[model samples]
Target: MNNPFPYSEDNKRYYTWSHYLKTKYKNKVFKVALNANFTCPNRDGTCGVGGCTFCSSYGSGDTIEDKFEPLDVQYESNLKIMQHKWPKGNAIAYFQAYTNTYGSVKQVSEMLKPFLFKDEIVAISLATRADCLSDEMIEYLDFVSRKKDIWIELGLQTTNDKIAKSLNRGHDYQCFLETVERLSKTNLKICVHLMNSLPGESKEDMIQNAYKVGQLPIHAIKIHMLYILKDTVLGKSYLQHPFPMLDKDDYIDVVVSQLEVLPKHIIIQRLTGDGMRGEQIGSEWMFKKTIVLNDIDKAMVARNTWQGKVLETK
Candidate 1:
């Protein structure tokens, strides 16, 4: 079968966003958001205590905090960014805020209808949770998929039950599996969010978790380094325990190893994440983010490794 990932050229992985967009559309496409203003279960007390251990109210908003304009404004501005950069390209209105599918089906459809009318928006990507993936929601997703490309992003931060509970993600591996099964039965594409070097998680655990994720029916993977942002539950825990974030070299080694085991066919949406400068609570290495990504690429090249090498052995 042909590789479905937009960026799979020459059977090698492409890592840049622009490259991925070009490859996906055979031209260019931007990810704009309609911002449905959905709330997360974690914050609503339906899940557990506070939100995910590493997630703050801003939802790791640092690089684009200033870009948090109104829904229409956000979409228009993002579209402008894409048009200015890739003049011939199109855009996708991605409902990227927390739990986009958490609202009623009618509400979601009504909110998203405006974007669908635009010629520039060829698809929609909804960032949501597994537990929130209801039958009605899947129906809506299938409905949207028929009109345009539909991508649903699920955060399965780690498969480790211990870490899931510790992070208060409020869902289990079973929940994630069920959600993927449901979506796979339909036509919606799936992307996953994972974090590495989280407190109380080990290198072995991270590798094992990635292997488990590889087994799931996912089309893309996004990996982010753990950050203890201030004013969050995880930040408070860090203050109490003072655990170390991954060192630059160690983090790169782990990321490279993970990539080696991750399916090369899967699109890599992100390699590193940015935390708010004032909110970042650990790791001097994080001060220079590119230093981390540069080291990861160099190490991968030197080792001649990609995401699924080690997993194949197992």
Candidate 2:
């Protein structure tokens, strides 16, 4: 009763990405969220128009470096900043904006090639939509897996069809599952992105989405809390109607419930996401990342629960 959860190696509760990387590579690992000037298929009209309801003008890459500079220049410059902060740590070249696979196989190859041989960079992360990945993209990614570490992040904010439709995500649950199956043929690690406090999602719906992802073949997951930003579709809508949102404590309870169902082997890539200062309009409490994270740790300890403590999904 006096001890914290017993799921992860560090014994905090969940299987964190930091612990996984540090133990596997024997050093600290930081992901450099980079931009490649890519665009989403939805905004381009391949799937839909106007992009996702909540997507920022930066295409969800607000924190990434300026895209005007060449990819190598950005990587090298950012590498220096990271190196100074943690002298012994390594970095992951993360292509974070838009649908990274929207480009041709050759274009995608060029974007990733610069980091393949970089000694200081240990891995590469590519974020994209499930509907945007073509067969050629998979072929090229598979070829790279022989030598370079690759992690593919797919955004599937919510499994609920109505919520996805409302968000204009432009992809269904089946599409996401199919893409994961195809990508599994390669050695690249897979991570699914889920969001809490969506427009119409219930507490149980969030729990169900977590269980669904855990049953899949993914190696990691990123749980983002929905925060309405200014001047976007979601922001405007929030101003008009102001849908119900999760308070800090309610969000903590929902997240802990998810952790109970996810398999211990799966890595928790993110617990909450941040919005650009002066841009986000809702869920203001999320700005304090440390408080949200600390509360999660405390909640798990008080409840005597841990990641995958239930060990059953479906």
| Best-performing candidate as measured by lDDT | 2
List, residue by residue over 197-296, the lDDT tens digit for candidate 1: 8777889888777777877778888888887787888888788889867877888877787776776566777788767778788676776867777777
Q: In model 1, which runs have C-alpha deviations exceeding 4 angstroms?
A: 1-20, 60-69, 287-289, 311-314
Clashing pairs in 1: 259-306, 259-307, 260-306, 260-307, 260-308, 260-309, 261-307, 261-308, 262-307, 262-308
After the best TM-score superposition of candidate 1, give how far the Cα of residue 15 lies from its true spot, in angstroms.
6.6
lDDT of 2 at 313: 35
| Ten-residue region with minimum lDDT total, candidate 2 | 2-11
Q: Enumerate residue pairs that collide in model 2.
A: none
TM-score of each: 0.89, 0.96
Instruction: Report the number of the highest-TM-score candidate.
Output: 2
All models, RMSD in angstroms: 3.5, 1.6
Clashes of each: 10, 0
